[model samples]
Target: MINKIDKLKDPLVQEARELSSSKKRIFKNKIQLRGLEQLMWAKYAGLKIESIFISEDQNVDDYSGFSSPTYQTSNGILKKITETNYLIPCVGVAEATPNNDDFDDFVLLLDDVKDHGNIGTIIRTGKAYGINDFITTNDDFDPYIPKTIDASRGTAFKVNFKRYKTPQSAVAFLKEKGYQIVATSPYGKSLQSTVELDKKPIALVIGNESVGVCNEVLEAADHIVQIPMHTGVESLNVGVATGISIYELRLKEVLTMLAEKIISSLGRKVSVTSKLIRRAFDIKLKEISEFSGDQIIFLMVLKRKSQMNEEQIGEQFGYFGDRLEKFISPLYENKLIKKEYEEIEITNAGEDLLAKLWPIHEKTENILLEGLTAEERKNLKSYLEKIQQNCIKIMKYEV
Candidate 1:
């Protein structure tokens, strides 16, 4: 339900106004959200709304249905509550989003970044590039402060932040957790993009606006990198530099991650090898025939079976319905197969096409098994067949 508060003296209004003070916010354990976007984002992040105060001119219908109470008040009161010259349409009082210790593969370390706006912008940029965990040296820094929230465009709600007593302590903790510390500095010899990265987790240290990364953290870092700049230009803004660094460094991490997954994951290896084989077959078949590798396989299946009903053909190649019809229609039009009722049989033309395509298949297989001896090839086939049977059994059990 919506209620009317005509005076600034109302208890709810006074409480919300008090939240403008940092000490009061902590004492009350609530944060004052200034605009509708902040309120929407806070709700989206599952923050509990203690109350909402909307300007008297705003449509009450727009503010209704929230589980928390909403009050309509004059613009002057809203201006007073938010401490801004211009009126904000809505103000929200919500429980401060709690911080968690959980860290991801990519994290941002803010070293003595005193400006709330910079912190907010870094968080916004970091979140955009898939870095959600932010570490800071300031124990009392509030991520939900109105200016920071405004700077972040409410993305602060989605960010997870943790505080450390000092940058050294934070580096120690991350190092213990197996994170590779990469600190940014203007004096560094290596460019940000050139830093070598592995598959281990990364903690990128963005330092103070005036001073770069601290000496302690720099000494501990696995790589000290900088963004190249023109000779006259001294440095980029902390937020801008952090954005650039995060993007470039994250890309390197992603490449390292992909390489590691390709090397270590059996499923990934099989999928990649299958794709390469298909691609090679497709290229080789194009030189010898008009049919695609899959289409030729379909023709070969018919030749092996002698004849198959439509349903049985679909089952053999995992194609059905319109897809199966689409696959068969072209071959039928070309007179490569004969259809009687629901049954299909390969024609002389289909047999002739397969004969021409068979050598390309043999050549592709030979290229794939170039280094393998005869005995090794036989054992490899046996192993693959066993793996395929195991997969089939697992699928059957699950079904």
Candidate 2:
């Protein structure tokens, strides 16, 4: 015999063997490794290895390539294990539990996903997408099974996984923590197009292989989103679907966060609304006439005042002399403005252009208040007036 069989009966070996069984184990503080790959993964995850057992033919020096210390080995039952089609050359023991509270921002909820392969792939893919927290319904399938561990490539050791008695329990927990529950289904709005995920701290629930997300869980969700599919393909493997959804949703969240950061940083140095107004005015002006924002302001002012001398317009807008004239020249060339000497007036064409431009301005305003209620709009207007008052006070050097 190339290896000893009595060593497999060691307490640690028995623990590893028992862990491989189908029994449900909670709060797993110890993980059993079956191969060098899993041991390497455990090392990478910073897990403290309690012990290592390798086949007699394998050299400890070869396995000691990792950061972990070399260990004494025995040819235990591992060498004589004929039950499994493939012999596992090594088995490792290490820490496996993660704090439930450590998961933040985004979480993945698996609903009755019975297949170990699917669960493993989901964890592996979710980790790639920045999802560290995984919750599964109380099902018989063990996420730490050798098959799952093998498929996850040991990513299971890195994930903060928790099991709930039911999907409803998971949803309730997330909801209580202020997470927006987004459920995946084949029948809902397109995942790519849905803006529901604009809300932060998302808890994405993916359902079982055959029946999809449970009805109770779906009913509890704040939004139902689905991936658009081609004809004849009724559904996707839960693992594949979860991976796709996580990629799309997590990327959106990251992009949204980056945009918010950029906006905040820019807000300290420049006016966001002012930039938007200038850009939107330019775009709207392009559609109507060859007028810049300054010229449009002058046109609207002239329209309001019915006509004004260049000096008077300059006094009102603080734009005078050659600069004022230069600004008006483009408008005049477009037939939107007519100037005789110092007096300037808006022509019929200018009036029509301004009329068309009013809708664009309205559209922009509507866009800003897309989801706001009437009361919110009223409050916003009041708030803007207060801001104006504060600005005036600052200009006057008032405290």
lDDT of 1 by residue, 1-399 (tens): 788899988888899998888778755668898878888888887889999999878988876656788988899999999877998989999987667877999999888887889878988899899888988865666777877888888888887878888888899999998999998888787889888886699999999888888898999999898899888998898999998998898789878798775677999889788879877788889997777777888788889888899888777667799998887888989999998777789999999988877989889889889999999999999999999999999989894
Candidate maximizing TM-score: 1
Check candidate 2 and list the clashing pairs: 4-75, 8-76
Q: Write the per-residue lDDT of candidate 2 for residues 1-399, one digit (tens) a residue.
A: 122345656675566565555562344556667788888888888888876667766776767566444344544466333136566778766767555766678998888888889889998998988789987777454677778888898888888977788777878888888888888887776565565465568888878888888999889888888789899998888888888888888877777677666767844434777667667767766775566666667778889988798778776666777887686777777888787776778899999887877777677668767899999999988987887787778889855
Name the regions of candidate 1 deviating beyond 4 angstroms: 6-11, 24-29, 74-80, 83-89, 263-399
Least accurate 10 contiguous residues by lDDT in model 2: 74-83
Instruction: Indicate the TM-score of model 2.
Output: 0.60
Instruction: Give candidate 1's error at residue 62 in angstroms.
Output: 2.6
Off-target runs (Cα >4 Å) in candidate 2 are: 1-8, 22-27, 66-76, 79-86, 139-141, 189-192, 254-399
